[model samples]
Target chain A: MNAMLDAAWAVFVRELRLALRRPAEATQPLVFYCVLALLFPLGLAAQDVGLRAFAPAIVWVSALLAALLGIERLFRADVDDGTLEQWLLADVPFPMLVGAKLAAQWLLIAAPLIVAAPLIALALNLQPQAIGVLLLGLLFGTPVLVFSGGFAAALTVGAPRAGLLIPILVLPMMCPALIFGAGAVRAAQVGLSVEGPLYFLAAMMVLSLTLLPWAAAGALRNALE
Target chain B: MSGLSKRQKRMAAVLVLVLGVGGAAFLGFTAFSKNMMYFYTPSDLLAGAAKEGATLQLGGLVEKGSLRREDGLKIVFVMADCEKQMPVRYEGILPDLFREGQGVVATGKLGIDPVTGERTFVASQILAKHDENYMPPQVAASLKTADGKHSCAPFKSLGRPAENLAGKPMTAAAEAPRS
Candidate 1:
């Protein structure tokens, strides 16, 4: 068990190091998220009330797109360097290694988005309670998004034009997360019980956590073959 | 055969796949259907399809000559989707773009009139087309005729009355003194 954990840790560190080396790649999505969030107010010319009403949808959609911007490269670097096949051959389990890599990707790509969420929410004129719920929704929803995107990324690692394929394959699967995430904020805005959508988002996170890494590992093996 | 039969291993994998995918789909579908709403026309509401007090969006053209101000900041108007009309009551200032014959979407609950028991939409928010060239997509789609042509029938019969300028009609464009 210790050996498996150590191996997972090693993979996590290695992936994080690689990401840190490419500062531009790591920061591009965050920049995209901020720019997109700012564009809504200017483009729509919405009043404070209208901005408040649509803030949840704006934030959630921008986050989803920003996450997508980085996900196509999740497995590409490892696959190109042949590190993926080495991991498969190592004594540590493949799924554990995959899970570790996904964790690192989530931290790099989605965690900052969560931290910056308040600024975006405030800029869009969201209420304090609604901002809290929006944060919670992102807390649960972003992981599911990363996992789903990672699975799709793993599947297409060996395919040509993976950049084009990833969004087409992943966007449909992401609809439920988007709906529930935005719905939670809207519910809180209207003083409705946010637990319903938040619970659904939590359930999605659980489902993704259990299933995606194994599926991604299987896809990696297929790609390596 | 090996310790575990190959067929048995395949069966186990298939079982897990089915349970996982099926369960997730079931949960996702139920949550989505429960929360997502399609914009309903007045005819749909009039047919009693919408349950009383259920929160949803209603889309139509604002009926001409039907807008009336009851009290300070309380306005009532009839909305028609060409086939039928429903009365809507809203409190607070309407959007600048809100006007007769323009497309609008009112989000609120369908309430029963206390005395008449007729269904009326009590709007919590009134959203009109943002500009002259832009129409809310749902409102535009709701107004499309069966033959795929855009129909302005809802506004055609209700002739364009004199522009209501600050709650009064301006008799002629030239009558106003140059600013």
Candidate 2:
């Protein structure tokens, strides 16, 4: 148990270290999210009320797109360098390592977006109460996005033009997360109970966190073969 | 290093997967049972699904001819789920697609009507929900009564004249001045 944890921790640290070396790539998704948030108000030319009404959807969509932005490179880089097969052969469990790597990547990508979400929400004129739900929703929803996206990325790791394939494959799977995450914000905005959607999002996160990593590891093995 | 065989490792993964999914399913199902109705129908509202002053969504078709324009922007209409009907009071510019005998979802709190002492939904926002099978009101009216007379039709005569805002450009924001 200790060895499995230690191996997973090592993989997690390695992912973070590798990401730190490419600062621009690491920050691109967050930059995309912020810029997308900025474009909505200008594009709509809407009044405060109209803007507020559209705020939840705009932020949630931006978060979804931004998460997509960072997903394609998830497994492709390791597959390209041939490190993925070596990790598979290691004594520590492959799924644990995959989970750790996904966790690190999620921390690098989704965590910053969660931090920046309030600023985007504020800019989009979201209510303070709804902003809280937006944050909470993002906290639960983004992990589902990352995990499912990582699984999609794994499926197409060594395939040609996998970038386009990733989104096409992953976006449909991501619809529930988008719905529940945005629904929670919309419900909170309208003073309706957010528990239903929020709990659904939490359940989705749990399912993805458990199931996708194992599936992703299997896909990685397939890619190597 | 705590050495484990490959089969044991796979077993542990399966166990974790099963346990995790089981736990999540439990939570999701419980939440679904608790809040299966995302929006309350008029029948659900009448059955005491929500308390007075509690915020919720009321979904139904706007009863034809039951719409009456009151002082200022206030409009009173009956929202019927084809089974039961509830009176709704809203003060704002309605959505463009908001018309009589169409699906509309109103979000607001339930309150006691001062005059009637009956429960009324005081809506803060109104969203018109329409599907691709767009039918003229006459077509819809005929189709609705095809399966025998709908009890909801009695309130049709009680409706006062509603201002036809078609072709007039209106702001999406109710209180926003026309620019």
Q: Which candidate ranks first by lDDT, i.e. highest?
A: 2
Candidate 1 residue lDDT tens string, A1-225:
566678889889987898899889888889999999999999776575578878899999999999898687778878888899898887666887999999998899999999999999989988888888999999999999898999999999888788888888888878888998998887677655566577678768867876898889999999999
Query: What CA root-mean-square deviation does each model show from the true structure?
Result: 13.9, 11.0
lDDT of 2 by residue, B1-179 (tens): 54878788888877998999998998797557444355677776777656676678788778778999989999999888645789999999899989886678899989987767888999999998764455577765555532222222222111111133322211222321212
Of candidate 2 chain B, the 10-residue stretch with the lowest lDDT total is B153-162
The alpha-carbon lDDT assigned to residue B47 of candidate 2 equals 72
Once fitted onto the true fold, the runs of candidate 1 whose alpha carbons sit more than 4 angstroms away are: A46-48, B1-107, B110-179
In angstroms, give how far residue A126 of model 2 lies from its true place: 0.6
Sliding window of 10 residues with minimal summed lDDT for model 1 chain A: A187-196
**With candidate 1 superimposed using the best TM-score fit, by how many Å does residue A14's alpha carbon deviate from the native?**
1.8
